[model samples]
Target chain A: MTGFDFPPPVMPPGVEALRAEVRAFLAQSQAEEGWRPDSDFGSDWSASFSRALGARGWIGMTWPAAYGGHERSALERYVVIEELLAAGAPVYAHWVADRQSGPLLLRFGSEAQRRAILPRIAAGGCYFAIGMSEPDSGSDLASVRTRAVRSGDGWRIDGTKVWTSNAHRSHYMIALCRTGPAGESRHEGLSQFLIDLEGDGVEVNPIVNLAGKHDFNECVFDGVTIPADRLIGREGDGWRQVTGELALERSGPERILSTFHLLAALVEAAGPAPEPRLAEAIGRLVAEFYALRAMSLAVAGRLEAGALPDVEAAIVKDMGTRFEAEVAETLRRAVPLEPVAGDRDGAGGNAPSLASALGASVLGLPSFTLRGGTNEILRSIIARGLGVR
Target chain B: MSDETLRLIEQTADDLFAAESGAARAALAKGEWPEGAWQAFAATGLAQAALPEDAGGAGLAAGLAVLRAAGRHAAPLPVAETMMATLLCHAAGMEAPPGPLALSTTAAGEDGDGSTVRRVPWARFASAVAVVGPEGTLTLRTPADVVEGANLAGEPRDDMALSGPPAAAGTLPPDTDGTLLMALARAAQLRGAMEQALAMTVRYASEREQFGRPLARFQAIQHHLAEIAGEAAASGAAVDAAAEARTPFAFAAAKARASQAAGTIARLAHQVHGAIGYTAEHDLHHWTKRLWAWRDECGNEAHWWRVLGTDAGQGGGAALWPMLVAAGTAGTDAAAAAGEGARP
Candidate 1:
């Protein structure tokens, strides 16, 4: 069979102008506010930084004007995100809300929910955390044990969510909970609840990562009251909604850009000309990265057209994560020492610039293939798409 | 080469292939040349699809339509090898073989003889063999004793013992082109096998349920399938680009990419399939086994990687950017040419 045509990722006409505007804005922000890039190992939630970005209409650029968005195409947003991530901007505050939750709510939430949350998300005043993974239901989301029982005109939720990234800092968490007993199909009987983290009955405890960072949390809900209207989409449709949301979460520049900092460090360390092995490794890595980026963009194009590129998205994530892992490995091999103190501040230290970053990346790499949906899961989907199985 | 021509060729092959039924598979099982199936393909001029118009061939260009039929059906004949042989002949200004010829090659140092042409592992099934000697001379040799055999698909890989002067000799340029062609062909076959294996695993996952849900619903299975799919896609694109490649460096890159993808995809397929896939009773073995053989048969991953690595070194430290630019242009040109060739 012939190979599908995958054109290289280039800015659409006028995209260069958009890039210039963003770069100017970022440059000014960097100079005026002393904006240091976010730490590679920690979960960052900088409200002021996100607010500045949102004020510039960069948070939800692809959404409609009514929702405080600029009505840009996904490709434009892609370029914007790439620049943001490449610059290591402190975007974690609005990352989930803008990257996925806002889009999800826009698509599946009730009109009231959208009207209430969309603007705040666009304004970057609000943040969201995914409460899908429970202690027992990280990958098998359908096995979520969180329960939400009807209480008068609202629901009382009681369960614990593990690995809730930035839950302590998020304004709201969209939790996938069982509204009823497990149905014949595991995916049935599940519903999503939008819980306010500041509410009285919710407790967010730190789940320190391997880097000893409080980026993730174990969020316990003890009879947390939520209005019935807070449910996303129809009750018992959590699986479909979550699956759609994952299409947003898993297929993006983030999967590949996790190693962008390391790449930059490598370029700096190697100078104009690198060692033979390092050069070859970097070359292969860059080629694969380019290919993976193309695939991700292709999926984005398909997603924008309202198509369910489930298999295609899976393929992108699998390849993207593998490439990131490879980059991490290559960097580790090329430079063996640790990044000395003040390396981030450019003190001309002998420390390995990527040492701390590599530590975090290595710990995080396993989850790249395991989290969202494991690599194996995506492969099966691809296999089915090919009609071999 | 027009779209209409490509469509016509594919349609014709599809029809003839449909009519031929299980003859190829049967021949494969019997370790004999699928002569009947070959005749059916010859009648449709598939053997000469890539040959020039003057060579009594269909003059189809190198592309998907020409390769798809062979891949989809797992045709038991050496259609690709023979096409490469025909191209070599044409390039050497020699007449292409008329009918029922099998083309094969031996690695530079692998054969038993120090100077004489030696038998390759898969050379047994050919009626005639094209041997390219170390001096860059190409020879068409007919062996004395022919023994029927099969490769991964049970397709015939007849054995022939060669012991005579090389016939119909012509010289190929002492460059990487011949080796590149071999690598490309092997990569193409690996791509085909990967596609089939992926299809098999996915279908199995959907239909095969455990714990009351389809295997596909499991995250582990999905991840496995995704890896396989990604690798297969990468391999397909790489090999297709390699086939149309002009430069040795471009060929090296494509070969490296394809070989890595093939090995990874095959292993993932087997892992997803589990016990049944490991057994000879299941058809999954057919694809996986072939993948293993094909990956190592031509220049293996290490060999090609070194070639690419050495090439990069020679071009200096900043060689990567230029090499990538060159590869991209070459890939685009080949794609455009293939597209043009498929036009009516």
Candidate 2:
């Protein structure tokens, strides 16, 4: 069988120094800002923290310097993002932008769009929300019903985007709207637009999650007008562009490290000398973590080498997300503590105690495998890659 | 050796192993040494691949790559055991002996010269056995009263009674970890075997029809194949990481992950193949059975899991991430090589 080539990752020079710098910055920021450590990126967002990180050139990494990027290696970007996630840093403000949107823009956005928006993203002053999913479209993203009609000199967007994370907070959304008919394939005749979230006839209603938090929103677009130049790529190339960025969105350390905080807390609770069974569980999880990280890093290395390893990226997400949920369950069964939702305030009052971290993780576990793409869809992608479909 | 040369050697090894597949199956069935296959492998001088560069051998990475290809075919021989034995022999300044080599990790008990060592892989076929321990390395040319044993795959794993002075004796290198190396070898083999199984299962699903359609068309079956593919990919990545890093932590992680994947991959592969996969006539057993045997040979998931857990525990919670990063990136290049293709 011809296996996917995931060559071992090579760390760039000065990576360790960069890692140290990020760590020192994070430690100091956490101390000074007094922000509570969240379970994952979605649990927290701070504009100041994102701006501070961007000022250090962590965001917009691996992009061309002409587009306000630091021109760092993908591996360097990997290390910085990995550190942020592992420390439970408040990175949601710039997460989508740094991960996929900026790269998408650099690759497909118009010149004026790049010059005007990319620098603001690099400075972490601008945030982006994805507008691919709808009330009818979840896994079958090609079945999106959102339509963009040609009106005046611009386009009028008239559809609703559901489960849009932070649409209320994000400045712009690259919405995949139907610009033409589905001739032979549904993936055809689709286009992406850089719709301003604050434009006329735009409404973002919060959808409280299971944990009683408002990270997601249902955005309604009623004839929202956008400039003609706001199109991300070619009019009919939206499907290709969106699929192109899946490798970037699916293969990062975020998929697996969502429960990292819980693991660290479990280790702390287990103490220096845990029981044999407890140690075994923890060790098994840790080993899986290491292997999954290696796989993700390998994919990042491949992407850095200019190969779009979609199948490999899907495998990473499939295994990594399962590992994430397994971590939560393993902790719940192995640790002898009841999960309790701690105080709502920041770390100044009550830090994320072990119970609270576990609580947050349990509540957030369902979305781990469901978000980005469902585990079923990911497995289907892998199966297709294996030529089974 | 340069990567180009290593790739060529790997290709040659893959072809040789593919050609020897029949001999491997026959040898296992008859419980005899695959003399033709062994001779063919020896002619390639792959045993010396893991030796020091000054010793006219390629580096560890090349050696692991060769072993990985060998494991890919499930060649019924002691390729890993022999390669590692030769490494120890050369490091100890002993001229490497001919024929297949068996490896043992158990130290000589209170009886010393007359001690009994168990679970020696391919002991009956071995021309010489290398017994490595904390004390040093010892080579036994002959053993008295060999009790024949076989793993699930029907490869020899005999018990031997040693009753004489060693043919060669020398101190091991400071970094020589016999168990870790053996585990790494098995991990590589597991990676190869899983890939083969995945390929076989994928092919079977695509070709075999059920209810007037290929089994692969069914979402349930496709998902099974997908899980197998996922595990195989993870196992390969883990093996590659460990081979590049060569650290205790890396090896432990690799073996544990591979061993863990071994169970799921074997189960899913068998499930997807249906009854045909379980029968002895089908070649799928050649890979699946070995996956079972290899997972427990050097160290299983549970064994290595404890090693990693204790490591993390001793380091405390704060040190987990750093330790993982160190193990994952150990021995990697300082940067991507210059002149590589850039992303568009």
Candidate 3:
């Protein structure tokens, strides 16, 4: 009578074998490519590796077979992505497409859109960027001022999208723009347009991050025309479509396991002969990690059963991002090493590769809470879901 | 395991809990045994809820449901303790005693190497005490000395000193560790209490208004409610996982996570409800106080965190994930089912 009815998580049968299979593939790939495990998987891009995973039917795994998908269960998809994130796979190339765009297209795009783009996504040959966040509207997504007015048999879009990850490299952008006037409710009158990054009058400017990465971008659309078929769902439906899309974007093992490589590296660095203090910190992190995993996995389980666990997903992100940030905090107190600037070659400074991993995580901490909806915005969303607002 | 069966258990427990909790609270506040309350609870067969079906017990899942229901109402029924006591009695082939039960699970500190566990729940009121001492697992029928103490919720958590050894009568199974069982029981109670707090907070936010609107309409207030929701949601999920699985790892993690949520949930619920939630007449403190007490009772967050953390930490990062995934796992298929389905 009084509780959030989160069904206890139970993955599909034999996910461990799938787990082992993934672990083996990651190890083999890491060995063959001589790449170090990265702390942030979603931020790091690799076209070859994304293609490799796609070839294995690991990307877009849950879609129907007609769309070049493996038609596996959501649980199976959960297992693969969790493994990919845990091992710090360079999944950025296909991360956005595989995570939300493909699903959105399948659910709301026209048959023509699905046929044209879904297979490319399934093949990991395409990349996409979320255009929900603008320079003016971060968490206040409904306040997006980007306009897409009517044109001859198409629409002309003019807006600037900020903090758009992978926008420069992405093939398309699912931009939420205003097609109509903002009425009494701010949520109404918005529409989602599929904008091509290569279209005329489109400019992508690099927004360098604290971590010295060029993944984040600011894209300006100047009267770029997109055909009517590019509209996702219907007119005046972008708010609902994007809200659901945000849920898909925010939830996932990625949010929780983004900094997992650092935690894993901490365990390895501490070794079996850890001091009491070190041991306690390790133990604490592990316990919390398991609990967070249980909660996150429950969300996935609910998703698989055809329920949208938006609040549950928000909880995961809120708790999960804090935990992700805590890894660095825990490392600082538990271990004794000043975080020197990490070189790309894993050398120069005497800091362990673990230190470099920690360094990378620390530099990206600000974005962890900011990117997938700010923490404050997430709390408001959670509150609304609780029927409080 | 059918929906009807679980529904029956939930409805019956909720009804009994609602009916008896006020009277039970009066007796508990006076530090007296609520005989009528215990009888009403026992009448539901929750005392034997965790016993195997063939043993005339309702099984673990049903027992947890009963505990959760009692916890939601703050019924002071000792549902978890009674079920555990009955299971132990049934296992050891002893006649189980009637009335209020208690369990002492904490290990004796290094200060005095005595065979005892301090702060045993309901020790003064218990007919018998199920204990895991330095000697071995045993239940003392008559406690020699009980230094009276109460947790933050006013429930008796007396320090029962065991003067003599076990009766040498029925010995508990070797596999039983009182501390772990206590963790499981306390976590279940915390889960129930948090649910009550969440429900109360939501209702209060929806009804109480300021500035010509319900408190729920305020963005800041909604944020606080959301915080509590997140805590309660995570705590509930973890506790359910522990209850359904009943593994050492699962139980430990559940206790740690639930305990961790307690501090924030109690604080924010009070914050959202404003000053009114602090009063004794409001009934909000009842659940929050219980959450405070139960979180630190069997094993606090720190205790269980270390329990899970050390084992997992020693395994290093590579082994940690597998260990977690393997927590409630049995052999191949059951593990996979737990992987793919619910508790095996």
Ranking by TM-score: 2, 3, 1
| Global CA lDDT computed for model 3 | 0.77
Interface RMSDs of the predictions, in order, are 5.3, 1.1, 2.0
- Give the alpha-carbon lDDT of every model: 0.67, 0.82, 0.77
Judge candidate 3 at residue A337 and give its lDDT: 66
Question: lDDT-based ranking, best first?
Answer: 2, 3, 1
Choose the strongest candidate by TM-score. Answer: 2
Residue B86 in model 3: lDDT: 67
Better of 2 and 3 by lDDT: 2
Candidate 3 deviant stretches above 4 angstroms: A1-3, A199-201, A344-352, B91-95, B107-116, B134-136, B164-175, B328-344
Which structure is stronger by TM-score: 1 or 3? 3
What are the runs in model 2 whose C-alpha is more than 4 Å off?
A342-350, B106-114, B135-141, B331-344
Quality class of the docking in candidate 3, CAPRI style: medium
Model 2 per-residue lDDT tens digits across residues B202-312: 899999998999999999998998888888888888878876766778878888999999999999999999999999899999999999988887878988888778778
Q: Per-residue lDDT for B1-344 in model 3, tens only?
A: 55578669878988999999988898878867888988888777767766666677566566677777878889886777767666666655567777767766652241124544577777777777776554434565565588888789998777766677654346655444446655766777787888889889989989998899998888888888887887777777776776566567777777788888889999989998888898888899889998888888777787776666666666777776667667744342222111112211
